[model samples]
Each structure stands twice: as structure tokens, then as C-alpha cells.
Target chain A: DVKVTQSSRYLVKRTGEKVFLECVQDMDHENMFWYRQDPGLGLRLIYFSYDVKMKEKGDIPEGYSVSREKKERFSLILESASTNQTSMYLCASTVAGQGAWTPLHFGNGTRLTVT
Target chain B: DQQVKQNSPSLSVQEGRISILNCDYTNSMFDYFLWYKKYPAEGPTFLISISSIKDKNEDGRFTVFLNKSAKHLSLHIVPSQPGDSAVYFCAARGLNAGNMLTFGGGTRLMVKP
Candidate 1:
């Protein structure tokens, strides 16, 4: 079975503090994604990496950034955490050419709360 | 603008009954649609999917029906069970959208005995 591991299951950070959320996938999928899930707004993509060292901003990328220096690891960075940034973060990965047809494998998710 | 929408926030059904979750999209360019099921503390898992070219797809107890003209889709679960209680999200992708998917707000389903 494919497993996507998140570094933290729950995290609390003070306002204006820098925060990092880490994810690693054992499936060796070429596509990795970071999304924030919120009530009534659903899961909004923050950033995604098609390959190592390459990243693209998604719809809600204003408050977040991401890094994918290694193929299996993708990291989401919050330069200055704020109260509004509190939400459940999810990490997902899928194969390359078949991304459209392939279902994404996701981690258990990290719940971040910024005070 | 919200491209995908799941109007109902919650639904309740009895075990052995049918549960239907609806989803709608405004983007005419979206050709691929998928449904994902999520439980508390876990990530969303793929449930079923139907392409614009096809109207319906079924897997086990789950079935997805798509209506391209109306930009509407629905997920149907037959003989719903207690374990089927979860949040269901509807996602859509355009032809060139790659792996990026636009998701709906989600519908929470509770199956009671």
C-alpha cells in the first residue's frame, strides 16, 4: 500500500511565527500537492510540485509557500502565521502522465492552529 | 468564483437505504469529475469518478452520474452503512488542468441504524 506521511498531526503556533508543514510520499509519485481544507470553503490548493525543485502557486497561495527540493518530500511554509491561517492541511501525490485518471493518495493531514 | 458547489451541507439516511449526494459546476471547460470521501482526522479518499464523455461509473456500492449539459453530477450509495458516514467532496478538472482540481464545499453524510 502507498503511504503519505505528514510530519505533524497537530500543531499550534503563535501569531507572526514562522511555521513549516512537511510531507513525504513513499509511492514515488511525480506530482505532489498541498491544500488547506476549511469549513464551507472546502479544500483549496495552496501549492503543487510536478517534479523535484519545481513548484506552482494554486488558487490560495497568497499566505503560503512551498518547497520540493527532494522528489519524495514537499514542504509547505507559512512565513508569518496568522489566526486566519488556522485550518487542516492535506498532502497528496499521484503519478505523472496519468494524473488525470489516477486517484491521488493522501496523508492523514495536519491540523494547524495559529493563535 | 466558486466553480464547484455542493449545495447540501449534510444528509442523513438509514442503513440499507440509498444516499444521494449532489454536485454542480459552472465551468464548461471541465471534462473530468471525481468524488472523494473523507473521515475525521484523515485525508479524502477517492470514491468514484465519471468523465464528461461518459454519464455513469460504478464501483461496488458507489455510483457516480454525470450530466454534462447541466454541469451536474451526483454520487449514489446503495444500502448505506454506518461506516459510510463521512464528508464527500466533488472535484472537477479541465482538459489542461493537469493534476489541479477544483473542489466543492462537500456534503457530510451520516448513515444511522
Candidate 2:
């Protein structure tokens, strides 16, 4: 089974504070993604990395940024955390692109509460 | 504009009954569709998928049907179980979308015993 691990399960941060959410995948999948889930909005992609040091912006990527310095680890950075940025953050990994019929394997998720 | 949409916000069904979840999309570029199930405090997990070429796919008690012309899809779960109660999200991906998937708002399904 593929395992995706997130460093934090629940985090509380003050406004303007810097927050870092870390994720690591045991399988050497070529793709990693970060997404945020709200009550009715479902899961929206924040950022994804196809390779180390390579990142692409997803639909909602304004307040968030990501890093992939190593193949197995991907980090999501909030330069200045805000109230609206508080949401359940999820990390996922796949062996290849969706076109290749690979479903994303996801972590338990980190619930961020920015106050 | 929302590319994918799930009209129903919630659905309730009794055990041994059938649960049907619907999804619609506006983008013609999408060539693939998927359904994911998510529980509270947990990330969404892939459920079932159907390619544009095929209209229907079945696995156990779960079956997914697609109507390409209508740009719609539906998931049918027969003899619903309480464990199946969760949020169901419908997702789509196109050839031009690369590795990303666009998801609908999702519908919460409750299966009662």
C-alpha cells in the first residue's frame, strides 16, 4: 500500500505568522500535490510538483506556495497565514499523471486553524 | 465558472436500498471522470472511474455510468451499507489539464440501517 504522511494533524497559527505543512510519500511517485478542502467547495488543488524543485500553480494558488527540494518530500508554505487560509490541507502522490490512469494516494490531512 | 457541479448537497437512504449520486460538467475537454469518497478528518480516496470512451463500469455493488453527450455521470451503489456514508466527490480531467483534476462541490450521503 502507498502511504502519504503529513507532519501535522492539527495546527493553530496567528495571523501574519508563517506556516509550513510538510508531506512525505513512501512510494517514489513522480507526482505530488497539495489541496485544500472547504465545507461545500470539495477539494481544490493548490500546487503540484512533477519533479524535484519543479512546481505548478493549480486553480487556487494565490495565498499558498510549495517546495519539493527532495523527491520524497513536498512542503507547502504560507508566507503570511490568514483567517481564510485555515482549511483542511491534504497531500497526495501518484505514480504518474491522471492521464496514465493513476489515482492519487492521499495522507490523513492537516487541519489548519488560523486565528 | 465552476467546471464541474454536483447539484445535490446531501442524500439519505436506508440499508438494502440503492444510492445514486450525480455529477455534471460543462467542459468538453474533459476525457476522464472519477468518483472519490471522503470521511470526516480524512482525505478523499479514489472510488471508481470511467473513461470517456466507455459509458459504464462496474465493480462489486458500485457502478458508474457516463453520458458523454449530456456531459453527466452517475454512481450507483446497490444495497447501501452504513459504512458507505460519506462525502462523494466527482472529478474530471482533460488531456490539456495535464496532471490536475477539477472537482465538483461534492454530495454527502448518509446510509441508515
Candidate 3:
């Protein structure tokens, strides 16, 4: 029973404002990911962290960044929120390995609304 | 370009009937496939998975079937229940690539009594 928790389930922000979304996992998985889900677009990866302080850009990383200061916590930062940025964000974690077939444990997700 | 595609936007089925959700992928490199179920306002939960080495994987009432040559896969739920009503997403990952996954747009399943 792995638990992945997101800091906020819902959030509202004005345009041009910076926003932070946090995620924490109890399983101590080495790989954490941030994804934005939009209607018709499915889940597109924004950023991922393989280890503390190590981050990689995913398919849709523009206008977004991530932080992994600790093993258990990963944060997604919206540099400047815009109306188009409004969407559901998901965080997931999994163990580190080559032959690992572990399924990602996901948080409930944060729905952010930018007005 | 959409690498993975779930053609059906929605499907309706009656309780005690079988519900089939189909998904297709364009990438031949994809070696692993997965199915996830998501309720409204909740993140997608892992349902079942199948590797390229095998064509079918079953778990409880859910079964995943993969067709490598056609680059297609499907999820079948037997005796579908109301609780099975949700959005289902099909995902794929390449063997050599990192664990990053490419997901289909998803199909919504509605089970009615």
C-alpha cells in the first residue's frame, strides 16, 4: 500500500502569478514525476526527478519546473500561471531499476485553475 | 503526433455484461503496455499490464490483451459493475527507454444496471 500525497487538491491563481504544487511519497521511491492532464490530451509528462537535485524535462515542460530537494518530496513550479495552464496535475513515484516493472503510485491529483 | 490512441471516447454497458475498451499504438518499440482506471477528480490507478513477451494478462475480472503485430491492445472487464465505471487509459513504454510512459487519450466506461 504505497501512498502518494499531493499538497493541494484544488487551487486557483491569477494570471502571471507563480504557483507551487507539492507531492510526497511514503514509499521512498527514487523516481518521481509531474504530469499535466488535459481534456483530449491525456497525461503529458512535465518533469521528472530521478534523484535528489536531479531533474529532467519531459514532453511538455515549458513554463514549468520541478524541485526535488529530498527523496520523499517533489514540487512542481509554474513560472507564470496563465489561463491555458489550468488543468489537473498528477504526481507519481516508482522504484529505481532497469528490470523494474513497478507500477507508478499516484496522488489524488491537484486541479489548478488560472484566471 | 499521437503515438498512442484510444479510438472510442466512451462506451456504455449493462451490469453483468462484458465491456471492452480498445487502444492502439503507433510505435513498434513499445514493449510494455498498461491499463489504468480513473474516477472523477482522482488520479489514474493502475489496473493491469502486459509485456511484449506475452499476449494476455489477467487479474481478477480484468484482462489485458496485446497484439504486437497490429500495435494494438484491449482491456476486457467481465461482469462489469457500477464501480467499474470510469475513464480507462492505455499506456505503453519502450524496453530500452527509461520508465517514461506514453498514454492514450482514454475511453470513458459507463456501466448501467
Candidate with best lDDT:
1
Error of 1 at A101 (Å): 1.6
Off by over 4 Å in 2: none
Superior candidate under DockQ, 2 versus 3: 3
lDDT of 3 by residue, B22-70 (tens): 9999998888899989999888999999998899999999999998889
Q: State the lDDT of candidate 2 residue by residue for A1-115, as single tens digits.
A: 9999999999999999999999999999889999998878888999999999999998899988899999999999999999999899999998765455778888999999999
- Rank order by lDDT, top first? 1, 2, 3
Model 1 residue A111 distance off true place after TM-score fit, in angstroms: 0.5
True contacts reproduced, candidate 1:
0.57
lDDT of 1 by residue, A1-115 (tens): 8899999999999999999999999988999999999998889999999999999999999988899989999999999999999999999998886444778888999999998
- List the pairs of residues colliding in candidate 2: none
Worst lDDT window (10 residues) for model 3 chain B?
B93-102
Query: In candidate 3, which residue ranges exceed 4 Å CA deviation?
Result: none
lDDT of 3: 0.92
Kindly give the number of clashing pairs for every candidate. Answer: 0, 0, 0
Q: Which ten residues in a row have the lowest lDDT in candidate 2 chain A?
A: A95-104
For each candidate, give its TM-score against the true structure.
0.98, 0.97, 0.98
The iRMS of the candidates, in order, is 1.6, 1.8, 1.1
Tens-digit lDDT track of model 1 for B25-90: 999988789999999999999888888899999999999999988989999999899999999999
